[model samples]
Target: MFFAVIPAGGSGTRLWPLSRAGHPKFLHPLTGTDASLLQATVERVAPLASADRTMVVTGVAHVTAVARQLAGLPEENILVEPSPRDSCAAIALAAAVIAVREPDAVMGSFAADHLIVDPNRWVETVRQAIVGAEQGLLMTVGITPTRAETGYGYLQCGPLIDGGPLRRVEEFKEKPAADIAEAYVRSGRYLWNASMFVWRVDVFMAELARQQPELHAGVTAIAAAWNTPEREDVLGTVWPTLTKISVDYAVMEGAAEAGRVATVPGDFGWNDIGDFHTLGEVLPADSSGNVVLGGEGTEKPGALLWDTANLVVVPYSNRLVAALGVRDLIVVDTPDALMICPRDRAQDVKKLVDELKSRGEEGYV
Candidate 1:
């Protein structure tokens, strides 16, 4: 059997204004539908498992929103985190939950805000990962890079597996500089790290025990208390104290050291939808190369844009915005805040968010 878990605990400050407190990006309608990212993620994983087999691990703050967005999923499948621990602890909690349910089931972990357009290819790739997991291999799905993007992690591809299309992972690299990213794109030897992982319950738990003993203790407690009232209370207490670490840093890196990690190059039209820069790539644009989202006056509604080219206007409301003699600029307006910056500087919006937070302007966010 196959099970899927989604981790949705991050505060998406990169997409500020629209993504505010108590409402993260996963709940935002980024796909031009009523379906949020969490909904889309659930739909993508639903075909791989039974209704009860899918789980969503998120923080307590967003539990209500998560519930409302994913009403199609079972209420018990929602695992609420009591505090802000990182991905390693979240994955441990998921593993413990699944271990109690199915002692030897194969499971896959994904993020709630990823965009995979081709469902058929995604299902096939997941099946391939499950096969790899049953053989006791920790599998990670990597995307073939289409551009020289320095924003994502990369994986060095090794030789192909003996009987399958999957490849052994030679190494993992963090986000690199522009030149290095371009060189990687030219070499065709690396794939963007999608953070998609698959492993069997027993294999995953054993690897956790070996590499992360402290986290292993937390997992042990949760597994021991499964189906009992103590599971939630004990996990709430122990999980917050867990070391904040990435699963890649804690498990995959060590697994690579032990020569047990593998990679499957999956081209399912994957996108993390992480930032505005990436969102622009997926959204529609005018002839002027402008991409707008989640608001009106997208292209100067009932107005004009004379002598303007390559401008993105994302108004928060139906307010009319007129632009003249502007090019390569992003104008995002909300009721509480308005942002106008060159498209090239869009990636640095995080710095602006930090400044806003330092100034105690939480309402703007």
Candidate 2:
């Protein structure tokens, strides 16, 4: 049996108003379904990993909400971080804790906010990854790129290992420029780096010791005291001293360069839903290509659109939002804030959150 580790840390500033610091995107049901993203994620992996074997690493502020959402999971399974330290620390902490219990356990780290349309295919792909992980290969599931998406990173794949589905990861590329993204898609040699990883706890800890010794040491110390009364004291003392970095930068990139990483190509429909534009593309749309969310169960319709093409409106306040003759626009109406921007400019929504912080408008943000 394999363990599932979910690193649910991001505040999702890019999806502001709907996703706030107090209530992040993972807590909201952006998908048409009623289940929140984090809950959906746990359910998706339930077939492979039972609730007892799954672990969630989240911040102190959101621990209560996370526990409430995942009520079936044991309280100890919900790992809490005192503060934000990025993916490397969060994932490493979980890995260390699992290592203490079972050193050779095969664990997969998945993001809480990503959506996989085809759960069966996703499970099969992860099964393949687990097979590779058991062979001592650090496995990462790479999505087969459907379009020239500049928002996600890319993984350059080499020849298939042992003449099979598993391929050697040649390089890990950051989010490329428009031309480079287009070129990558056209080449068909690159896969979107979805940050999905699988490996044995011992293997991952060995790699962590080799690549990021300081981070490995810090997490190891915390894990030692995780079940003891000194858990909080150890986490508070050592977490801040650990280097803050993403797992991609601190481990995967270097491991790939050293030919220690392998990837399984997954064609299952996957979307990170990083911004409104991406969410609109994935959600159901009307005949005029308009996507409406929220206010559905209420007395009034969530949105009323006429002659609106490719518009995304999210009226969370249960107020009817009526738009006429609007094309390629995004309207997000919350109780305290209303954001109007072109659909193409959805990626820039984080700028609005930053502006609110600069203006000392924390309530709105």
Give per-candidate clash totals. 0, 0
lDDT of 1 by residue, 163-239 (tens): 65888887888999999999998998899999999999789889999999989888778768867978778876787
Model 2: per-residue Cα lDDT over 1-365, one tens digit each? 69999999788888988999999999888877778889989998999899989999999889999999999999989998888999999999999999999888999999999988888999999999999999999999999999998888999999999997999999999999999999999998999999999999899899999999999999999999998999989988999999999999999999999998999999988999889998998888888888886524556457778788999888888687999998999999888899999998998999999999999999988
lDDT minimum window of 10 residues, candidate 1? 294-303
Per lDDT, the best of the predicted structures is 2
Each prediction's TM-score against the native? 0.90, 0.95
lDDT of 2 at 220: 99
